[model samples]
Target: MAGTGGVSPSQTPTLPTQPGAMTPGRIGCAEIVRDLAWEHTPLGPRDRWDPAVTATVELVLTSPMPMAFCFGDRFVLIYNDAYADLIGTLHPAAMGRPAADSFGELWRSPGIGGVVEDVFRSGQPFLEPETQLTVVRAEGTRPEQAFFTRGHSLVRDSHGTIAGVLTVAAETTQVTRRLQNLSELTSRLAAALTVDDVARVVLGYAMASFDVDLCMFAVDDGNGFRAVRRIRGEMLDEADERLPPVWKRLSDDPHAPLVASARANRPSFVPDGEPLRAVASDRHERRIRALAVLPLRTASLKGSLSIGYRAAHTWLPAERALLNAAAQLVAQAAERARRFEAQHGTAQLLQRSMLPEHLPELERFRIAARYDVGVDGNAAGGDFYDAFRLADGRLAMVLGDVAGHDVRAAAVMGQVRAALRALALTEPDPPGVLAGLDRLVTSLGAESRNEEIFVTVVYGVLDPADGTITLASAGHPPPVLRRAGLGGEPPTAELVKVPPGAPLGLGGRWQTGLVRLEPGDSILMFSDGVVERRGRALNDGLDALVAVAAGASSGDPRNLCSLATTAVPGPTDDDVAVLAVERAVALSRSATMLVAAEPTGPSRVRQWMTTWLREWTVPEPVISSAILCTSELTTNALLHAGTPAQVHIDLNAVRLLVSVADTGTRGSVIRAHTDTMSSRGRGLGLIEELSDSWGTDPSVRGSTVWFELLLRSTSD
Candidate 1:
């Protein structure tokens, strides 16, 4: 309401005329006092209105607060500009209306009218420190419940009797809702597990709970900072390119809010929100006006969480304390989750290491080896297979099964395998290797005092120069021979009969059996578990195995192993190991090139490899990879071993197998993880990255580093 410089003498309220005749100073009060219906009130009319009633109405209308005056039996009402804002859609229509009609629902709710009535009857004031009331608001699309502290005073009329109640109130809705939301957030974050799970839960809840425009959590996983963000309850890509400013600021500023919080181990409140606005989206940069970062700390980890506000938000002491405490809990949960994952992974790695790393292959034969654990546990048992070329360039393969299936069995398996390898390098024949291994197992039993730690194995020696296999069995299953197709005869398989000699650790000397395999002939060596079923007889299981192999594609060892798995459709108690190799009757043209183990060895090897691949018309991609593998392996042998090296290249119908024999016994294929590795160590890593499959077999002379790549069958 606009006011004159001062009320003129002529315009002063001096007459006892009609209500409109006297101009009230306030707009809402003037409109109410001048209404024609006011003459019907207990006070009669504006001309007869009590001087005290007029004074209270003037106090309400002129005051800058959410105040309303109620007087007489009807409790007539009047409010100021501040109260009009609170009334929202119930404004002008509610003016000059009764208190009951002015605040219809609020009056009826919690019997607020009763408080006013009681204050009207008594001369004392009625006060409620803070209470909840649902009322319509401009900010809300519907009615919103809020907390308000209200006070009501009794006002008398012209006769000095009790008139009505005068109300003064303040809303505390935002503060009250915040406490409730924090409690809910604390409850939900309790069950979060992984970092991703924590981010999904916390970001979704924090944005809505704190009523912020954005929420982000950055975790330090010992490597680097990784952040997860949610904007108004919607997740954004953690690595979103548009958020470079935020990432850069966090990285560059040592004293930044989040950085400071982490360093000081406390929360940093940025009331101005300049830091947030500077990095926020263009639309929200102007909208968000405050930011805060809380340090997340646990026994093993420390991190930071940030929040941005779209409206002016002052961080309360209670709010800060709540977030800090909750973040500590979140940090503990995240730390435990990571620890559990690391421990579980370590256990799995230990179990997997007991199995073969990679199967060895040669041009005269392709090798396939597979070891499957028992149905009861993921831990590998004592079943093991190995195919390694001897120092003399002849291949020696072994399929062994140690009795029992526990940790002790696995330990003995390793010992027996080491003894067999050592014996193969010295003993010239398969029978000699078996006899030597038996004596070694007896000595191992004497040392361990575990007589039950016996082992059964089928040992064979293959001469690549000629097609011959010297085989011996020590109570192990006999080898299944898939005969070569010759002179229009279809291929057939027969179990190679050999004496089932006493198992190792029992002082038995096994005899050898020699087989001159024709071209296209193959041998399948496996542990007894492969053909031993729960209910079927051993002979029946063997027949089933042959049938499965017949139906399977004999293209590679992997295929044979996969077909072997189909033989036991149901669960089996024991672990299984299957090794398949195709015999070469008529050999292909092969080349052996020796490169001096010097600084130029790798370069010379690569040049020769390129020439050989071009002569064979190899694919360009394969040729490039071959050249790279050859250089890496050759360079590693020269730089690390300081011994002469040899490269044997064999290309046939189905595979391209390259063997780089080095005098270095320690050089093997590198694992994917390359931490704390030297130059040669990383070179081994490069071979792993470039080759399809590669391995190293330590011989008495040195080690043979080899890799194999599959080629289409028609390439044969």
Candidate 2:
């Protein structure tokens, strides 16, 4: 047989080993062994090699990732220090036992022990890319968790023949968790655009990634801390819709423990026992037991993300590292959400501010205007109306609706409204003004790229001398007409309907019409939401509006608008703008006044109003109402109408017109809350309750607001 001790080349059974192979002094092999065997000495310099090899065996046996060797049908496990920490108590007397005796649960796993046995028998190195296992130790209370195990076999020889196997593996729990969290984070980030959505994503990520029962994020709003996002069931039963129990304020609370500690770049982890005690009081103990708070700071602002568990659970350094990384990512996402919200909110506010602040006073008309945004949550729509006195002393009125609901539409609406205001001053006639607006829109490159933004507009120039309204339309609905003489009888009004011409930017000619206005005659102009609706005929909406306007009460514009709005008895999905212009009816022969020099005092003013009403034959039940109305109006004018403001009355035959003149320029807020227990603000609103027709007039010097009440006689 050709030298049995060392076979010939053709009959070789194993590869030849180089000199000094398996020796203790080899570079790569000896270095690995030394690391597996020794620990750095804390007191002084220590030798790298362990002479007896016992310390080396122990170090390998207690490693975090599993390491093992095989000797002919026997398996030996050599783990790092973490393995000892897990099973040291149970195996105190069995430190160096075989895998079959010490950890049967791990040794019996499929392909693990059998593969090591085969490697020892065949003298072959074996490797596995990935393996899964459930390690059930004898000491732990719960079942073992799932872990991915990867290992490779090391072939060893004794006396020129293969005799043993060596292996190593690492648990993959952290890796799996990271992948799941990343998937969830991507999904949430893609869908989240609002502040609330962002908060929910951060809190949800913590709950899922850290395996916590309660997770929440709080924002610092300068004044106090409030919970903006929270995981499901994270809060106590009583805190369903309420804010955090204790909202710590930085101004008054110098020792604001949570914020201060977070600012210091330190986290506080509590296993149990009043985890949030520094921020909340004893009342929060029932809900919060154990918590870890990590401060989230991005772009100079600081907030906190908190994770809580029902019971205290100890955490390892690796777990803390994972949480820190996640918090940083959350901070970045929150910053992005904030930027998106800022842009969106600014657009909305700008659109609202661009609307007419206050209606102008037409010489003989009582004008009331109302604007309502859509219920749908989309970008701003191009619905606008304006009533103002032109520089040449004529009344100019315009109402229009843009073509779409988006940023582009809102910006176009804004530009058009501004441009129309400027052009109306130079163009006297209605058609002339609209034509000028059309030319400007085409010339300013607003309609570039063949992209069109058509506008349906109705502009009018009212001659205050004769109450004649000269109107123009660019594919807009005809105006509605109502008169005081036709009240309660369904006013016989007609739509000054014109031919269907193209809207603005359609390269068509503009059309104009004229209608004479009488004292007590009203004209109503509105967007499509008022006269056109889905699933309903356009004529039906028009007829219904006509009937409601005929039945509306003359004294209050707010109530009249409300009545017309509710006429359809259905939902409106578009923005609505209703501008009503009516001539206030002059009073018949029934009014008188009693003037008092000392009208400044509240009691005296009350008495004077009461005596004057009594002399004018006012009803007994209505006297208290008149006094209350006058008192509120007088008081509000004194407090908010600016200095040097004065009150005056123009009493005629059939009506008493009370005028309050002041220099205040800001518009008044009007509310129609009907509850008796509510506190109604200001005197101007009270005038609406007592007067027949009321409105405000603003001038460069000041403003004059007037209200009227029907009188019984002029002889009192």
Candidate 3:
């Protein structure tokens, strides 16, 4: 007989019995037990078995919980239907076998066989709150981790001796895995900064965690709800894939699951396809059999998240709780993003409104400017660029930066810009204009009683008649000059050596440096942001700018401005402002003709071009090609622009440039393949094939399409 030490008395089983009550059921594990040849095993025939063993077997077979009873010293197994399911494929055959034979190495593992042996020998009752086991759930699959809480109780025979041990188990694998996934989700959501980033994280987690076929994230966009949907299978067509993710809009329809869930501020689940099919308006939605919609309710944002399955499923309580928790995280992130975007938009709008809306359009020179905020665009920086005509008809351009990133800095910039323009109206020289700004900044600092007001500016004035530009600096970076090559020499770029004065507000002397620009020459002025990288030296950034500007193929002011802004490789911590002015080629002779909007426009332009070229003693080959290119441009302007076109021709010693300008809203010219049969789209192709160089310049009102033909070599 086994002693009852090292066991809890409460966990002992009550083995009640009735005489001759060993009737086996017709179905389930009971029938399998009655049919097994027990005479081959240690327990012998069923009729010969002890009454206690029979009673325990009956209890194990009838109980709903997963229970198995080990009888005698060999620990032969007798389990119910639920226990058979717990062991997966080791059923029927494992019914009457020893526990070691059925569980194999698992039975010999620590705490499993030892606990059963202890309970059987000592009559002790043991309980394990949670135990992890590697189990092969199917016949030919690898083992996977399973968690369970199991209890073992001793069973006694009719002679009042412990005969076997009975065990019960409850699996907790699903709950354990879900909690771990939730923890990981929380960590990932913490790093999400933007609304789109949050959506991507949430959608990926839901799809992987729930093993769903489809997931969608929808946000309320004032007018309606915009949704970003992802599917696991090839349910969407190629055309749908090309469209943006926010293409679908869910209105305030009560029938829509997302809208209804958001309106009621709760989650909605449908286990069967019939209910979903009745309200399904999209073909994609009709294919789903199960769906769960979780509403995201936040102070500033209203949205909903949904998961779908192609097979019917029951929405378990644990799954629902996890989904709701994920939605809460998403809502919080979205609210934060919404607030940040709102502030960023307001700051950008304020800064842009204070800057000049348009640059003065000069006839002999072209001007272009660009401004970019820092990578972290949460605040408005004090970087500004302006180009205006002075009272003496000289173009005045300034690029400056104040030392702050706030509304106050922007306000001060606006003041400095306005004061510079007012002073330039009277004092057109670059040095005088900067001197007046220095005093204004000093006065501004004194009025505010703050000595932190710092400003750096590089002001310039361009005289179009002599192509001379005068530049002055107030502790700002020197301007770059891209001098066009003459007589077969390549263009060269260098930083202007202007005397650096103390920054404004400190009161220092300012001096000017003058440079004469030739035809196709350009001067670029920029704030320090353009030449200041986060970790690199300022000289290195300056050298990189010179290289990029010199290597640029086009001398167009807009192109140069764009190249200067992107001269640095990495992100910049400050705002950038670049202003570029290019001196047009000196024309020996120029002619302009405003062609009518009639069908005879191309013919008339061709006749005008040929007559002018002939009178100028131009070669017949040049005249023929120019006439053909001009006719193509004129026809395109009329066909596409649907407006009158101005044909302008400029003749220099080296090249002849002809341009067709229109007042229409067509802002770009697209080149197409030259098809002889096509009448309308082959104009640009002819220009490209016939001219030595061709380009287009898009402006505020219209576009200029021009082509240049080299009449003589640079040696001429």
lDDT of each: 0.64, 0.55, 0.74
Better of 1 and 3 by lDDT: 3
Error of 1 at 305 (Å): 9.5
- Residue 477 displacement (Å), model 2: 1.9
The CA root-mean-square deviation of candidate 1, after full C-alpha superposition on the true structure, stands at 23.6
Q: Which model scores highest in TM-score?
A: 3
lDDT of 1 by residue, 1-716 (tens): 11111234333111111122112463453455456476655556677665445655665555444567776667766665556655555555666668787666555534356676776777666555465544444442454444466666666553445656667654543433443343334334444434555666667667666767877787665544556666664333332211111221145345455555665678777676467544443575446568888887766676788888876677776567556644654565567556644653343344446555665657667776666566444344788788888999898889999877677777778878878888898875877888888888888888888776778999999887676888889889988777755785666777887767888878887888888666667778888888888887889888887776665433334445656755755667887888888775435546788999678778888888888878988777777877777787777666556689999887765457787877653322334534444433455555666665565543334557777665543344
The residue-by-residue lDDT of candidate 2 on 343-462, one tens digit each, is 655655655666787788544566666666564433577888888888878788888988777767777788888888888877667777778777766664454654466788888888
How many steric clashes does model 3 contain?
Answer: 0
- Candidate 2 positional error at 645, Å: 16
Clash pairs for candidate 1: 653-716
TM match of model 1 to true structure: 0.43
- lDDT computed for candidate 3: 0.74
Comparison by TM-score, 1 against 3, better one: 3
